[model samples]
Target: MKTKIILVIIIVLCTFFIGMMLFIKYYSPKEKSNQLLSNVSVVDGKQIISITAKGGYFPRITNAKADIPTTIKLNTKATFDCSSAIVIPGINYRSYLPPSGETIIDIPSQKAGSSMNGTCSMGMYGFVINFN
Candidate 1:
């Protein structure tokens, strides 16, 4: 009886340890690429040029705005540059983003159909460029 109890206790402890190990392995956080949005539009004419950052993490843009020559509008603040900006894929244009707390960019209507891309702290996020 004593031997049986000891054996049962050892099995129970082993099962508990195995369960804990699996839980930790499954639930542990790992580094992952940040989520991106599809086809963010700024205005019509303007296009995103390039995004730069000092770190690998996303860069927050402040007082973001879109400019089509003289027209400019306030946009929402983004956790990263392209996190809020829109791209059209294949376009070779970029925007001069301001350093404020606003996010969102407005592209000119005339340039809406062309391919464009947004700049991110990590890399370029393309949108609406391969729709031909």
Candidate 2:
């Protein structure tokens, strides 16, 4: 019947639109831009990376050297958001940062062409450190 065919067509279009929306939301180039303050440095053979946590982690992307002991200095100034708590699954490091201070986290030397990811407690904010 004509009505049945039209209903089927509408259902197909709706399904396709929903699928595309989900794809774009979950698998897009949202993280392609690097933040301005990567703040990565090396001293005494130790790599130190700094990140500011407020509404989100600044410098969403950072490039650093591999095969060196690393430390992450998370700075939070009057941060009362979910970003105050961070999780680094690569090192099994999870902690709640003070509302206004710096927290240091250590990471072992990583192989070249590897990456480390950190996210807020609710997984809403995040950052990435690429070692190469």
Candidate 3:
């Protein structure tokens, strides 16, 4: 019957839409907002860069001062993923952060054109800080 065919078509479309929604919600690669200055701040003559670590590292790219002393503060809350194990190979720094707290890391003065990069232990998430 025409009614039966229409019902079947509607049910198929609904099922397909739900499946697509679930795929995007769980499997998509979520990146941080591409803000140039949203995550950088200067305090007491030191540049402090704050980034969030949860499903992924946010504000993935940051810009900061090079000549002044610098530190990166990572904020984590209920982060049980691979991102909890942060590694900064350039500084020979690696640590397992607390599930919900702030982890501060000190960095030596960087040259104006230098950049610092960090990654999760599994390398699935990362962030970059460019000095200028």
- lDDT of candidates 1 onward, in order: 0.38, 0.90, 0.87
Error of 3 at 110 (Å): 0.8
Residues 4-70, candidate 1, lDDT per residue (tens digit)? Answer: 9999999999999999998776665321221232122344544432232222212233122233321
What local lDDT score does residue 72 receive in model 1, on the 0 to 100 scale? Answer: 23
Number of colliding residue pairs in model 3? 0
Query: What TM value does model 3 have?
Result: 0.71
TM-score of each: 0.31, 0.71, 0.71
Of 1 and 3, which scores higher on TM-score?
3
In TM-score terms, candidate 2 sits at 0.71
RMSD values for the candidates in order, in angstroms, are 10.3, 10.4, 8.3
Name the TM-score of candidate 1: 0.31
lDDT of 3 by residue, 1-132 (tens): 999999999999999999999887766633223343468878888888998988778778777888988889999999999899999999999999999999999888899989988999889999988899
Count of clashes, each model? 29, 0, 0
In Å, residue 128's CA in model 1 sits off its true spot by 12
Model 1 weakest lDDT span, ten residues long: 31-40
